[model samples]
Target: MDKLGNDELATILKWVQDPHDRKSLSLVCKRWCKIEGFNKVSLRIFEPNSLHKFLPRFPNLLKFESSETISDTQMIFLAKTCPKIQRLNLKFDTFDASNDFGDHGLFALSKGCSNLRSVILRKRRGIRDGGVASLAKFLKNLVNLDLGFCKMITDEALETIGKMGSLRSLNLQGCCLISDLGLSFLANGILGKSLVYLVLAECDRISDVGVMELMNLRCLEELNVAECGPKVTDIGGKAIAAMESLKRLNLSWLINVSDDTVFALAEISKNLVSLDLTGCEMITGDGIRAFASHKCLCEIVLTSVNKFNANDLEELVFGCKSLEFVRVDARLRSWIPVTEQGNIFRPNCWISWRL
Candidate 1:
């Protein structure tokens, strides 16, 4: 095995997908370590100390992820080493405000990794507008940008993102400071025509005006505006209804959305597959009834819905034959396996209880 050519060694390494297994393989021999390094294109670093040791091994790395505590110096080192990197994710699930990685590190990355197309910086508290501005200026090829849970980002960061004309997936979820003004920048820019997936969940400042801007994204396939209350209303629903390409939508916790908006969404999105109306108290059985006409709908979640009872759900089951999964108030009545036409569920049907 050690005497094999690079192509043969790469073929053997490609069979090992799990990181732990790959590490075990690398430890077998020096030749195996070199083969593993040459074959690897993506890596997730859990320890900051391994940066210098591992980076040199994988010279052709394209994607890098680090959820551990990493400083600006380490980030700069990564960029300097992997100039061909296309994706960089530096999300920290447990935020530490004292982390020193900030604009300086990101600036270095933007300068060195010019081919960067996807960047996910979720929960990186130190990152702000200045760091992102550099990316917008240099990373013209960016396609997917996820800044979810980045409390530091505001309208200024969004302004820079709008200029990235090639962007297709944008996730700004939990960026509380961003208002309709930020969305307007995107809607009016070149990204409006290119973006396919947009997530604005918990951006409460955005209203119907901001949502209306999304109508210009004709290629949009998935939209999540969940929990954007008091501002997002039926007007936003109207705008969403106009997007014919939308397949999956989450309107959960939008208290103002009633049967009217729900019905309109059901009628318009003919190809809709998954719909979540969780905590949408205003929607009645009438709106859910309209979903029966949906030819492709497979999954429906109606948790905490007030109006629908046992009988209404039965009607829905009978009407929509394509439905493979349905989640409702299971506590309302006894749920017995129905042997209706033959089986109301597919072989893989599963029931998940919220409580």
Candidate 2:
């Protein structure tokens, strides 16, 4: 048999049972060294030298989860090696807020990756406004981006991201450093044009004023604001309800939202598919009734709402034919027709009522 070609080696390396066997093949010759692909993937970083050793091992990896110290050279190696990488997760745990991923690595990866899609940078203290600005310069076909807990980013970075009009999903959770000023930049720049799924959980400083800007998203579908501003009360709920295309909504821990939110939302978003009112305590039976009126409402999660009784929930189930998932507390009345998809309801959590 002719010596295994690089393509064949790449295929065999994926299925090889032992890591030593894979490395043994990789060290076969210079031809194997230049295979233009890699297989080693894990979340290990030994201060400064582990990256130097493992950076060039896998050039065409699909998924990368990195946590420890990230250097500029390692960033370049990964970007150039894994040109078509689809998912990348980069998180930094330090509070130093140093710009770790510089513009050079970001720009290179953005330009090199053709099939790139989902990118998440959670708690990344190394990525700042300048690094992101360069990254967005090349990522024009991006779909999902999560900048959760990236505290050093500013409005200018968001402005760069706005250039990608094809973006559908975005998560800005835990970025307490960015104010509505940055959000204002995002809303006015590109998010309003193409965004569908948005998550702004735990971004406390943002008030309704920032949300007011997002109302412009014509194709917006899902929104999650589990912990944010004082404005996320009925007023903001009403603002979100104004969007006709909204399908899924999460207002789990909003303190100020009352029955008014339910009343307002009942009329505006007729196409709602799923809803999460987990901790909105002020809403009683009336709020649930409002949600019941939605014809397309499917899954509902009301985990900690104190006011809603069983009658209201039953009415909601009766109103929507599409409802499949329901989560409530232990105090409410039992459901009408006990049905658990594929599983038996062994334990009864509510009182039985027939009126």
Report the lDDT of model 1 for residue 269: 78
lDDT of 2 by residue, 1-355 (tens): 1577767866765687675775576677766655533545433344544655655666656777766666677777777766767777766566554546655666666677756777777776666777676556667677898888877666677777767688898888877776677677777776678998888888887777777777877888998888785666677788888988899899888988888887877888888888888888888888888766676777777878878766677677666556666777755544333453213222322212222
Candidate 2 yields a Cα-based lDDT of: 0.71
What TM-score does each of the candidates earn? 0.88, 0.79
The segments of candidate 1 whose C-alpha lies over 4 angstroms from its true place after superposition are 1-35, 334-354
Clashes of each: 0, 3
What is the C-alpha lDDT profile of model 1 across 1-355, one tens digit per residue? 6477989888878888899999999999998888888778898888887788879888778999888878899889988888889998877878775765888988999889999999988888888999889988889899988888888888888888878889999998898999988888887778777888899999999999998988877788999999997788888887888889998899999998888887887788787888899999988888888877678888889888878765566666667777778887666444534444234334544434355
Q: How far out, in Å, is residue 317 in model 2?
A: 2.1
For model 2, the stretches where C-alpha displacement exceeds 4 angstroms are 3-48, 92-115, 333-355
lDDT values for all models = 0.83, 0.71
RMSD of each: 3.3, 5.3
